[model samples]
Target: MAFSTPRVRAVRHALTAGLLAVAAGLSGMAQAQSSTPIKLLVGFPAGAGTDAIARMLGEKLKDELGTPIVVENRAGAGGQIAAQALKAAPADGHTLFLTHDHSISILPQVVKNPGFNPSNDFVPVAGFATFANVLAVSGATPAKTIDEYVKWVKTQRDGKDTIGVPAPGSIPEFLVKMIGDKYKLDLQAAPYRGSAPMTADMLGNQISAGIASVPDFIENHKAGKVRIVAVIGAKRQPLLPTIPTFSELGFPNLDDYPYYGVFAPVGTPQPVIDRFGTALQKVLAMPDIKQKLTTLGLNVAYEPQGQFAGRVRTYTQSWERIIQASGFVPK
Candidate 1:
């Protein structure tokens, strides 16, 4: 059925107006995204290791993404605060969370309700590095090796067998329990607000030992203030070549390493994820940045979205089995 000439003209004009309006709306959205600063959330205090990494990445990412990057710290409950914040943010790619494995992979399984589900609330942007955790004995202790440390615990402290952990229900705390079970000692985990105080107590001999990331103890270990007896990884770490891995020492199941990655709110457009991830890939590839991160005890390896997601799944599953085997009911 042919319309009148006036009706046809009216339809053509309406279609043109609709197309122009849609184009204008898209252009406005593009302009807003280009001008808006991206907020990078970290669930740790300023000056913390995770905070440091976030700042470093933010510093370089601004140049690559062509927009200012702002790091926001929401310190509490072992990254639960920041994870919740990320969950609550709009899924418009303006907000991201930069964290290690604990927040995304472990916390939810341990906490009864952490207020955020990584798989449901966030999308993996990119993974920049992997790191190992170590068992470091305070300088006050005479033990330099894992065996010697066990002996010291069994003999030196008549009744005290406590290891300081950065946070309660953390991986280090679980490791403390595992070590106790293995050695048949009454080891207790003394939780601290963060690694700084935990290391201070270790330095002051208030705690016989502590378990934390390699970056947490590397400087002190190099200064002879603490002795790293064991690390958790498949093989020896390059930074501390002489330190034996738990796997090398006897525990083959403790070979998985934790990772550091960036995540955006779920439902972020694919172009946004791809752009941010591509920028991250370039940032991680810089020789100077790689050197700096390696110096901080990180094994720099850039994995894009798919590989990073797989890494997160594998690491999460490994720890899930370990946690379940430990008979730890989430609380």
Candidate 2:
């Protein structure tokens, strides 16, 4: 137990060096986690609803994660482009795709190859909101409800009554056919590139009515330019309580609401996914964030990772059955 002073000093020096090395390692890990800016990808154009939501979430998430957040717009093939980009991005927790059910659940059933299967290629980080498609007409139309709109269509002596939908083979487009079958009307479904153009035509009276998300028509409906006759979901939206739901209107088959969720590519570390999910849950719970999404006609609902992934699976299966029943052939 007797040691020279120099030997004791050498032992102290070695212990100090090991502690410094450990500290340096810890510092590097922290720096790596905080230095990189997370890239939040949106599969729609800049002004689209999905893009707007993504930017809003990104703004809040940046503060929560203590890192810069960049929203990248890929914008094509009904969100297939952005989904594919996320699949190819690094699995370092630095990239995510914010999208609605169309890209994750519906597109896979309708497109021959969406480049990535949502359930297979991606892991759900969190579910932020849910929305319902609405059946709305221009203010010029004398229809106060779906029943009235159907009756009014019968009275029109015009060539044919057309209902604009955001895109072909989308839920809105398919609902038009479902409505026609239910009412025995010969209404035509006109597919527009997106809700913006569809809304434009609806505002101009070029189209008798339109089928789009409630947010797509909320502003115009409030402005007295368009009237939302019916919504597709189990219950009336809180933002538009006056508008009845498909179930309330007796169209029970159309009562399905699609969700908006954040997803990371498969093979990402579990810690990263969990961290992002936690941050997203916090972001969604923020009062202002909830208000913004609520005003946009979206229900601010948050589902954690496991629950969100399960929801994606259930939704995909449900959409598969619906799309099959609708006789939609993949393009």
Candidate 3:
């Protein structure tokens, strides 16, 4: 182990040179990543809940990322259009899709040619939150609980009791079917273009009941314009603790909550993925971000890349079975 002074100096010089080269490479990579503006694509209209969440995250992420983040809405086909656009975008870590479970997990099963497979076309950066669908009735309806609502529905003058759902083949629509089957009630799901119109119809008494996300009905529920009879989740939502969950109400099949996450194109670099995911975790951990999302009736659940990707796979499988069992025919 005896080495000459000259040999030791040579070894030290080589080590220093290698370390400097590595540091320079890393600096170059960081500069490249921050050189361009990040585009966060929302797969819904401007005023939709998903769009709001995307914009909120973009605002906070821009500060953490030290780069401009622009939110673009490409609304159509239940997020299929935006998913396809993300797939076509360059894998430079400059484009991301801020979407919910509908576009990522449910659409592939319901749409014959959705143009992109979430599990295959994109990589999960991070999952921000999860939200439950709610079953609510108009204030005019003389019912408060699910049991009472079932009775009132049976007594409707029309032979078919209609429940308005935000969209066709959505979780809310499937829940309407599951609830009807569980209680042996004659119920029909009336699919609307979106939650806003469905909620409007509910307020106008055009429909006896409506099924949408808690946020879709929270304000109206609080104002007494609508009554949230039950929420679709494992337990009662913290924002609406008074409303019972479907599991507690003897319907465990409706207890699944959908997720919201960020994704990038398939070939995005690992370093970029890590950087963005770390920034997202930091943003999700902020007190104000958590509070804001919670106030919107979302569970501030943050899952990193590995766990989020696994969740996406499991959710996809679950939805596949649920969609098939619901007898939904792809369009």
Top candidate on lDDT is 1
Q: Which stretches of candidate 3 lie over 4 Å from their true place?
A: 1-35
lDDT of 3: 0.85
Q: Residue 127 of candidate 1: its Cα lDDT?
A: 95
The lDDT of each candidate is 0.90, 0.84, 0.85
- What does candidate 3 score in Cα RMSD to the true structure? 5.4
Candidate 2, residues 251-316: lDDT per residue as tens digits?
655656789998888877666777778888899889999999999999889999888878888877
- In terms of TM-score, the best-performing candidate is 1
**lDDT (10s digit) by residue, model 1, range 1-331:** 8667988899999999988767656643573468789999999999999999999989999998888999999999889999999999987788999999999999999999999899999999999999999999997789999999988877887635889999888899989988888778899999998898999999999888999999999999999999999999998999999999998877748988999999988977666777888889999988888899999999999999999999999999999998998898998
Candidates, ranked, TM-score: 1, 3, 2
> Candidate 1, which ten residues in sequence have the lowest lDDT sum?
23-32
Q: Provide the lowest-lDDT 10-residue window in model 2.
A: 23-32
TM-score of each: 0.91, 0.88, 0.89
lDDT-superior candidate, 1 or 3:
1
